[model samples]
Target: MNNNLPEKQPPEKTDWLLFPQEISRDDIEKEIKKTPIAIQKILNYYLLTDFESKYEEIHLFLKHFNENKKIPIAKINNPVIYKIIKTARSIQRQIHKLMGLLRFREIEGGYLYASFTSDFNIIGPLSLHFSRRFPEEKLIIHDTKRRKALFVEKGKLYEVVSLNTLPSDTDEESFFRQLWQRYHQNISITERENKKLQRQNIPLKFQHWLTEFKGSCALPQLDGNRENI
Candidate 1:
């Protein structure tokens, strides 16, 4: 007797709601339908060239999916597509904000050490910022979220092992951060503060980045005062 596991189905396609508002569901479907088969051929060639050594069947399946499925262009009208696009855009914005707010510190041996979560692909914009801000210092931005890092040494950028490999963890930079936080905290006045202006100054999503944001850090060491909490 032979027992075989049931075949697993492909995961559902991503929703289009998350996509840019300009790209509609009908537009997407229409584009897909109108595109020549040559596009798939080109895609197959590139995929096989890139990934065939590890997964030969990947190209075959992609080709098959391309031929078999009807991907509508205007996925914007589709609720599922809309949701996917919307979520993707939100994630992109968060990553962009994080990169913009990333603080870089110069370390020993001309090495600049900066760290952040790498949930989204924020490295590209980050490199742009560092190139503009610090033309002299070679740097690395270790993104803990994805356990990956980018090294910008002598103006060249490349991916490297995570900074978790570094000798010190958060302990390495916690002291300076605490001092900086204290200085900022001390200057704030409760009497003249405008809650609306505060919200406008720092959006709720990015409040996690603010040292004054209550309960941001779970650890007592990183957590600030709890007057509001």
Candidate 2:
């Protein structure tokens, strides 16, 4: 046989490029406004959706969006559309869960302090719900995972980051916690204890911060002898 080398195959072409660009918050807000109302809601929700690969997912969505001027929903089989829908659903679920599961305790300054780590950046969305409900009360919804907090005071809402500290709980808080735990235990029906169903509804991740959960009453306690402000 004649010694002959096989021809080298050309490199496979990619449909996407990897150029990194600096995008400002205002610019992004402006771009979001240019989209249809329905699409704008999706884009806003995507901002609060938390995922490890969110940046890549959003980049892909933007690429598709820029080309089509709208999501190609007719192509339901498209991976980008599927991902966007999945992310939006996840964010919605977390928001609903927190609306019920989030527990706030009264602190020294008549402030309601609730601490929880959410899979999504939900504090911003939760602020509106809580502000409407507890309009007059000062509230702090702290996101332990992101080290950020949403402060709702005097009918205004704002966010602060890298603030991991919390003030001491008031004596009334401790007393109420005991009563709450007792009420929870007294109302339980041992026969109807469906651990699987409970986990399905409340989820184990959320249970750790819920007031009705066994050890959660002890949470949100002051860290390192911090004096109450």
Candidate 3:
């Protein structure tokens, strides 16, 4: 902690560049210069995706970007360029979906915690998002598969050294959690239930951690030619 820091408050926005320290984006832009929006999206994909041979792919993409800044990216047919572009698009979709789907709960010390697992390494972008979205509120967004967490406090973000599993939510959390769960159940039109399509919109992989699906054993299941709930 540097006591020489300014007394001003941090900004209420996040970006592609993540500084582990309390450095502001303005300070970073002074050093690295502001990256273009197109390049920033590519950087987000580079940071989020863990595809094999990624080092080679990114090196190729950056080389191409430098040489052909004026041409449309879709016209690039190099193998590495095409693969990275596709992977970037996949990462973009995962980030968009997971941001909307994460469900936070009030935990000990009044911290809000949300946990989920994903095939891609996506915790960084999600933390950047929620930190801005809930600046005053403390938050912990955990990526279960990675066994890591993003800790945010007072609108400043912290990348933790290590984290054991958090204790259960505050006792008071149960009441509101149940209320929301019940409300979700009550408004449903079971007569029009379509498990197949429902799963299409909200994949079963994400349902296990969602509150509304809790304690409900009738979740859709399939067995070849037979469907079971």
The residue pairs in collision within model 2 are none
Give the clashing residue pairs of candidate 3, or none. none
* Model 1 spans > 4 angstroms off: 1-75, 165-179, 192-229
TM-score of 1: 0.48
lDDT scores of the candidates, listed in order: 0.53, 0.76, 0.73
TM-score of decoy 2: 0.77
**Error at 23, model 2, angstroms:** 4.6
On TM-score, the candidate that comes out on top is: 2
In candidate 2, where is summed lDDT lowest over 10 consecutive residues?
Answer: 216-225
**lDDT score, candidate 1, position 183:** 63
Residue by residue across 1-229, what tens digits does model 2's lDDT show? 9779788654653334355555555666677788778777776788786665455555556556667654464354557667787778788888888998899998888899988888778888888899988999999989888888889987789876556567787876876676688788889999999999999998999898876786533434443544543
Q: After superposition, how far is residue 55 of candidate 2 from its true place, in Å?
A: 5.6
Measured against the true structure, the TM-scores of the candidates, in listed sequence, are 0.48, 0.77, 0.73
Better of 1 and 2 by lDDT: 2
What tens-digit string does per-residue lDDT give for candidate 3 at 1-229? 8789878644643212232335443443342224467766665576566665455445456556667878776686667677767778878887898888899999888899898998799888889999899989999888889888889988788887787867677655665677678788989999999999989878899998798888642333333542231
